[model samples]
Target: MSYEEILLETEEKMEKAATVFSDELKGIRTGRATPGLIENIRADYYGSPTPLKQMASISVPEPRMLVVKPFDVSVIKSIEKAILKSDLGMTPNSDGKILRLQVPALSEERRKQIVNQVKDLAEKAKISIRNIRRDSNRQADQLEKKSEISEDDCKSLKDEIQELTKKFEDKVNEYFDKKQKEILEK
Candidate 1:
């Protein structure tokens, strides 16, 4: 592949890694309620597992409360069961048509734990970005070996890839810091 193609592919992959990390952070509970936390919860709908976002409407009626109203009333039980099955550690209070989830205050220890989890996720994203850089470097080296690119051009391409890796790794760190602050907030 050409140098430009290799660089572009590397950047796109790194961007995707950062985005995935951000989305995952949204699912990690904080001191408040948010639709993102439970929207991805899978429930049995007609014997098939389906995401809660597809089966219900989730609203944060209060700072610490989420109201879930299923379009199909019959799925209320399934939704409740899904919440119970999730790692969220909260039970859904259901009344036929709607379910209410109360997001409890995070203890100091829990907040620390969540922060640690965020750190782990951020590290994983950085690892993914670095892997992309490695692959792009390899492609550049191959091009140099084949004489498709001059030695200087290959070295320049590797430098560009390294810069992209640093940029994306910084973005991941930014997201992690933001999420850690959110989780630790009182």
Candidate 2:
């Protein structure tokens, strides 16, 4: 592949890694209620497992309360079961038509655990970014060996890849820090 293509692919992969990390961070509880925490839960809609967000309308009527009204009220029980099966510790209070989830305040110990989880996720994202850089560097070297690019060009490509890696790693760190502060302070 051309140098431009290699660089663009590397950058896209790094961006995807960062985006996934950000999405995961949204699921971590921050002593507040948010639709994101439960939107991805898989509920049995008919014979298929569907995301809760698609099966229902999840809203935060209050800072600490989530109201989930299923588009098909018949699926309320399945949604409740899904919520219970989720890793989230909260239980849903269900009526015949809708469900209410009470977002409890995070205890100090729980907050610490969540922060640690964030750290782990951030590390994983950095690792992904590094892997993409390695692949891009290898491709550049191959291009150099084939005489498709000069030695200096390969070196420049590797340097550019390294810079992209650093930029993405910093972005992941920034997301982690912001999440950590939110979890600990709230």
Candidate 3:
């Protein structure tokens, strides 16, 4: 394959790495209520475990409140139990039809802990991006050794891959900064 095609593929992989990191960040909790918090919750519905969103309609009734109205009223109890059992540290209040979850204010220590967690996640994302760059660089080196691509062309491709890596790393840092600010905000 041509150097151009190889660079294009590398860029696509880098973009995918960034997307995965963004999805992971969404799963991290903030002080405010967001529908994404429960979107990943798995509930036992009709003898099958499925995502909570598939079985209920989740809404942010207020900044700190999440309301889950289940399509099947019978699953209300199961939903409540699932949430209570989850790592979110939240208790669900159900009135035989819908479940209400009130997100509590984070303590100072809790906020710091969350910030640390966000930093850890950001570090992992950076590592993944770097891995992609390493793989692309290896491929470029192989092409250069095989003489399928000229030395100049291989160097240029490596430079482009490095730039892409830096761009994605910046994106990860930006996300981490925003999340850290959100966690530390009063």
Candidate 4:
């Protein structure tokens, strides 16, 4: 592939990696109620493990309350069970027709722990971005060795890949900072 193609592919891959990292970060709970918190819950619906959002309408009834209204009332028990079993430490209260989840306030210790976890995730994303840059560099080097591209062209391609890596890393850090602020806020 040409230098331009390699750079574009690397940029695209880095962007995807950053996006996935951000999505995972959103799943981490803060001191508020957010749909993302329970969107990943897998409830046994018709013998199939499906996401809660797929089977119910989730809404933030209040700053700390999440209300889930299942289209099928029969699945209420299943959804409650799924939520109770999750590591989110949230309790689900079902009243025949709907489920209510109250997000507990985070303790100072818990907030610190979560901040550390977010930092670890950010580090992982940075490492992955660096790995992509390394792979792109390797491909450019191979192209240069094969006489498919000049040394100067290879250097230019590597520079572009490095820039892309930096951009993605910055995005990851920005996401982590925002999450940290959310977690730390009382």
- lDDT by residue for model 3 over 84-124, one digit each (tens)? 88889888887888999999989999999988998988898
- Compared to the true structure, candidate 1 yields what TM-score? 0.99
TM-score list, all predictions: 0.99, 0.98, 0.96, 0.98
Where in model 1 is the C-alpha error above 4 Å? none
lDDT of 2 by residue, 132-180 (tens): 9988999999999999999999999999999999999999999999999
Question: Per-residue CA lDDT of candidate 1, range 20-84, in tens?
Answer: 99999989999999999999999999999999999999999999999999999999999998999
Better of 3 and 4 by lDDT: 4
- A best-first ranking of the candidates according to their TM-score comes to 1, 2, 4, 3
Better of 2 and 3 by TM-score: 2
State, as a TM-score between 0 and 1, how close model 4 is to the true structure. 0.98
Task: Give lDDT per model, in order.
Answer: 0.94, 0.94, 0.89, 0.93
Give candidate 3's error at residue 182 in angstroms: 1.2
Best by TM-score: 1
